[model samples]
Target chain A: MSSWRKLAVAAIAAACIPAALGFAADKGPLRLGTTPTAAQVEGWAIAVRPDGQGLPAGSGSVKDGDELYANVCASCHGTFGEGVGRYPRIAGEGKLTGDRPEQTVQTYWPYATTLFDYINRAMPFPSPHVLPPDQVYAVTAYVLNLNSLVDDDFVADRNTLPKVKMPNREGFNWIDPRPDTHDAACMSNCRPAADVKVSQTAEGKTLTPRTTGPLDTAMPQ
Target chain B: MAEQPKEQLRTAPSSDRRRLLRTGMGAGVAAFAVAASGRARADDPSPPADPDWSQSLGPGIGDRVYGNPSHFEKDVIRRNVPWLTANAESSISFTPLQYQQGIITPSSVFFERYHAGRPTVDPAQHRLMVHGMVDRPLLFTMDDIKRFPSESRIHFIECPANGGMEWRAPQLNSLQYTHGMIGCAEWTGVKLSTIFAQTGLKPGAKWVLAEGADGAHMARSIPLDKMLDDVLLVYAQNGEALRPEQGYPVRLVVPGWQGNVNIKWIRRLQIGDEPWYTREETSKYTELMADGKARGFTWPIYAKSVITFPCPEMPAKGPGIYEIRGLAWSGLGKVKQVDVSLDGGINWTTARLHGPILPKALTKFTMEWRWDGSPALLQSRAMDETGFVQPTLTELRAVRGTNAIYNNNSIQTWQVKPDGSVFNVQLA
Candidate 1:
């Protein structure tokens, strides 16, 4: 009896989705999408899982990465992977607990495989995903080395990249405990009107747009 | 005392701000002065017997078949802060909220947040490949998607880091920069669950990794349960094919989630067991707390609002009887009530919800204020049906700290000077 019930459920799922659409359907399975060929699916499967499940077969060393980084990434990521103009700082042991915590990979990133996955899929902006697997592995190794997360002569591959221990790996395990701060919808006597003070304005250095002068007409005309 | 401003009773489905400008009434040029936000002075020269438009035969109708806003609205385009990103191509721009009146943000001027530059995707060439953990992997074209039953619903897509710059201080002077990272639109698309029925989920399919076709290939992992709940593979917005910037051919509309999760130019959705902690999920978007530890997957936008009329861009003009208008929204559910405060949140008065108040969508709220030309700090607090009251900046920062670059839904305060000029300011 149980076997028949299981088969019955599977049959309904394989048939048309009458329940999902809130209507009756005589057609068996709306099946609109084309059955993809293996190559068609493989061409777009670029995501790299945390366990290094999708890492392409290739390897590179810190030494090779240094040269490759200079050639392709240095223009935007800076020579030492510090950063350029407004580009993000790639490599550094920037502190996390500060007024302006520098978001460097070594300090903030949770997984080392993320670095490889990102560089493999999207890197060296203006011409992203142009790097071969070997170059991506090399660039990944050099960036990890620049942050002192790995040794000077470290090599990175599918096996090695997943094993790399990010400093902030365990830092992101907290559940988002929100409605974090709950405030009552207070009506009156919320606070003394005199207490409110303009602690800060956009007029702070380098941030000012317009203060007292005629407001820049945001008028449509 | 003056009569309490009448609540503009809304019977129709959708009525925007520009059309509802009859709140202030007068006659002839004076009426124009009152209605046009004092743009045309009442004392200006009276109109001639026939104006140029009325006298002359304008350009033919063929000149503008695909209609656009009046020429006067040309300046009301998306504005970006240059200092925000390393390159302009991968950056974001803000909606001119001060000029925008209705709850539904026009598709053309919708705020843009693209990881890679916007791609002009051809629907003929585009295909959405669904594979990985599924009973039958399939490749869907635009026609294949539209073949399935479609749904149209209104929702707002807000970037998680909408007000990141104003975390430590009120750093952006303009309302567009501070609060314009949100846009509401009526999206038409097939529900992902309906399509997933064709490609049944495999036994271990716990998550779905959605990847975009942008140069960045921006990908984010969404829980399978969420995908089956309300996710839509959208192709149209606001009664038309979606604007190219909003993902022309198709995009993922993870209703009520951050804009990033609503992957634009979506090409592939690989159902999987584990979350794909792509560059966007881990290296960015995660909210870094005060302890240096960061919170991951902080998705829902809490109740939030801002007084737009007296904001930096739309400052008050000799504050008389003016309709104080603003927008409020929540990801949890429909906005239950919106309270406006002229004195920096010291007290609150419930404002009238002006238009259709949909779930997980922008709800326009308005309050009439007879200003006495006094310096006041204007603020609005939104409350969702979930009973979550919008918290102050102090309350928000106290829990998340000043470092949470994402999910800054704290109430915003606009300082109205005695001269009727408004500026962005944070109360101490």
Candidate 2:
């Protein structure tokens, strides 16, 4: 009777093994879950398109922006939007197309949306993204006004922010278009096969490679 | 050459003692001269030799407890541009590649590139919350993370824009700016898989959003597959707590991904069905191709290598029996081979690779060369274990048009002048 009972328990355990494995395999690779609500997610979702797709519904005049700039942005970006230190100045430094030229926002930035996007995402010296949407718009407007790209009365809101035209819109070009060109000079025109040159200088005089007589056997073992 | 004279001046007698000694020597020598003048005599004249290192300070204080590099290495320092970015906040500085030798960049001298600058985060207040499509939304403290089984691996983290300057004409003429956005460290952390297992991942979760506690609140959406496969919640690097510049308290170490995606000061990990489409995903990091449409989700940085020594502005020391050294890394895996070409790209010689060539880690390569004072163009080509070869600048431009400013990993050439000065030059 005991043997029969043990057989029955074994039979039951065998039946449950596949089911447990199947249940584990059914769940795909990653653990999924719900995201935060729109309000809760607002802090992480601030992407303004060139056409102002995700701009918030808030408005601020250029005058208000100017005042806000003086109080906040001007300390580092300069009163007239000229950059101090590594902080990029807003006003134009003209196009620098030399071999090595500074790529500043005023001279090389392609879109006004980038300015708005960057400022909205990462700004202020101490606290980043702590500003409300209206303040971001106002600061953007003030920077634009200082850049001479916008009017004093121009109000930057969800609609007007995208319409601002930057001067260096076409400043950047795409990567070069060229096939991998292998130089014949490297392939076939390498310096003629000559004997390896071995020469040295001692006391400002050139010397040829010549082994002296006898190896030093007195060296420590 | 000028150092010998300076050393002599330093070793000379003190100013006050030298004056007194000179007066005494003059009086004695004059008296001796009068005696010697009367009788013909011959004496040898020679200056005393300089003293050895032991004569000064006898190994100095604290020598028994700690050791430092030779005093000759004092010139090595991390370089930065003061006026490049405004203020200490939201700036990027470069590493001095020319000054470094090995594949591993010392934590102290590692380059710092911050968006909103380094944030002072208190570890006690730090909490990592994992929510979303899981059976249980779990919140773990710094101590709670330590309880889990941990693993350590040396990995190399590189910025996607490391070689951005080379996308156009060879802009800056140094490997430091061209390739300094990379660093290697032995990171120790708990596997994200363990954490995901505790949360009980639900079916259909595809992406995970990792967020930081910095002022910028930097965040990025990583594919769920990669997260479960190899992601790590690293707390220590090089056997020490994470450096403040790299990440302090805890950071999400995404092996073989862009530097920005390895979010520092990581606070939240939300598992989701689709990407969050955060600003970083939609606008930034996306490569704007030559075509009007942009290429989104260019995640894995490709294999790249740069010859650090004998680079432009770093002259070759009259070239005979010189060591050719550089760094090679790949987002894919170990660097299988690195070829050094001295005569332009004519003959390729395999370099001797050093260190444990682990997956997604920097591997140092070296080769010996004998130069004969002739102008030679030097270049390095790295091939990863994945069979992906490092291409030339011309080849990179072909696939990714000249318009793109990021992910420019091409074989860089440095023209060595006869006088030993090297200049950045492109070989077609």
| Fnat for the candidates in order | 0.62, 0.08
Off by over 4 Å in 2: A1-121, A132-221, B1-51, B55-68, B82-84, B291-293
TM-score of each: 0.88, 0.67
What's the true lDDT of residue B39 in model 2?
33
Quote the lDDT for B321 in model 2: 73
Q: Which candidate wins on DockQ?
A: 1
Please write out the lDDT profile of model 2 over residues B86-164, one tens digit for every residue.
4455555566677777767777767776767788888887777787777677777788887767889888888777777
Best by TM-score: 1
Q: Which lDDT value does model 1 have at A79?
A: 89
Clashes of 1: 0
- Residue B98, candidate 2: Cα error in Å is 3.2
